[model samples]
Target: MKGLFKSKPRTPVDMVRQTRDLLIYADRSPDSRESKREEKMAELCKNIRELKSILYGNSESEPVSEACAQLTQEFFRENTLRLLITCLPKLNLEARKDATQVVANLQRQQVHSRLIASDYLEANLDLMDILIAGYENTDMALHYGAMLRECIRHQTVARHVLESEHMKKFYDYIQLPNFDIAADAAATFKELLTRHKSTVAEFLSKNYDWFFAEYNSKLLESTNYITRRQAIKV
Candidate 1:
């Protein structure tokens, strides 16, 4: 009889839905109520960790591909990604890291052999702008910047970013006062310019004059030693 009251096991779809619900709550929750928000944030973090473990598996078991597919499909199908990005600042450090990894891994998940995350991102390019702008926010820079780099692994998204006005911002982003942020920005900068050779070539060719001018001046001759080194390497 006691076994009849046991909680039902959650499927991957159930996990995705629950995680999305928590993320929405976080996004809408007011910081005025710090204690309650903290409690919800902790729950959100646990859900995110559970999602990660389902996709990546734990030490005791390997990730189930079907579960990963379901999670990925639901994640991109709904507003989960957007909510996570917007609510990131409200989360604790560990939660932010888990969320970041979740974002990064989903970029590679395939649904029915199609890269659906790319499709979702292509339809939601404005999110990229928010991510790029994050470089200016010291606290959110690294996390958003990492997710931004992963998003560009999709050629369409990379092309959008390359053509956007944000391309010019990386020159300063890579030299930000925070070493970790600066370095992460630099890595993202390199990934953008090198990832899809054809798209990058086309962009560079069209914007060669202004782009190279900024590259040679701001990055090559920047006051920061790491900036100069990275510029030369890239």
Candidate 2:
């Protein structure tokens, strides 16, 4: 009877909506670095962390709450993924890291639970493309690059990214002027090539002649010591 008098927990939908609003506000606010904005950003990070905990806290022995899974499904249903991607480039470093962590967490969640559908990817193919284009924005490169790696963990996503024409852009990305951007791109490049060995093997066998030639000339021979080191390591 006492439980009836207790306050109910906020729904995952409400929590996600609040976090999304905060992020959008932070992005558009001119004085984003102001104390109030910073406070909101901190709250946003806390919300994501809490969502992660809720979605992933259960042990294999314990069944996860339907509410948690519903929240995750709602996150995609609301097209909140687009919100995260749009705000990523504008977020401060710590905020961006937290956001990326949330994305990675959500990606892993689908693997453990069937509540979130794989068809979500098919519906949001543009989100994957946006992540790929993220490299074009130096400020966003690392954050989105991290998200991309997590996204490709799924076999379906890995195959799509592997086969996309965008795969060719890695050669240019690996040689970008900024060390951090170039390095992050190279890391994603390596993951794409090595994560699914069978898939990569087939890709290489099919594209062998020009792929290695371009890789050798563009990355291996680059004047940047980091690029050279990375290419040789690959």
Candidate 3:
């Protein structure tokens, strides 16, 4: 019975210790198995709430340590890329949210930039799907949308979403009743289009009426101006 209770386990401390030990081990190992290191980090990622609690409980002055660069490289390897994609759906919302921050930290590591870029781009697709699904719940939509937009901006992932049929439908759906929601969606869409001219052209060519009806007339005129400018350049 005492063993069963076991003081409920100090999981947060254990997790921090394990993560630090993994980093140290990976650093000292000559010809370390990077895949194993990444596996350990991925396991650590599963306890995101515990990790966050621990991190926040500590002095606010102490910054979160970056994950090892080799582990990030291992994660970007094609085989591990598939594993990450598969694991993303299993992560809870808090874990998924923390992942963005982790990726940002990894990106700042000089040796890990390329690997972080590749892994982050792949991971972003799954995150975007999660964001879109959350949009179905009105209470969560705007919050999730803002997070999604930030992710898209950081990763340049909005191109994929802007080109997706599902996202187009979502944009249209948001435009139906709430002017504020519609305006927000339009602003996001406009930013996406600005980044991906060809995608916007294709979308506008196919769905001109919907855009014109839902967006303000001034925005429509501006879009037309851009389209005409591009046509002339062509």
Off by over 4 Å in 3: 1-46, 49-58, 68-111, 115-120, 123-127, 154-156, 176-187, 194-210, 213-234
Every candidate's lDDT: 0.91, 0.78, 0.50
> lDDT tens digits, residues 10-69, model 1?
988988898889888877767548788777778889999999898889999999999899
User: How does candidate 1 score on lDDT?
Assistant: 0.91
Ranking by TM-score: 1, 2, 3
Order of quality (lDDT): 1, 2, 3
Range of the 10 consecutive residues with the lowest summed lDDT in candidate 3: 225-234
TM-score of 3: 0.44
lDDT of 3 by residue, 1-234 (tens): 777766656543355455445444434453657787567556646544445443333455453334244444433443333333234334446655664444344334444335355346655576567566655655555545555555555434765676566555553544435555544555555566665667667777987886566444333333545433322322
Q: Which 10 consecutive residues of model 1 have the lowest summed lDDT?
A: 25-34
Model 2 TM-score relative to the real fold? 0.78
Model 2 regions lying over 4 Å from their true place: 1-7, 20-46, 53-68, 111-117
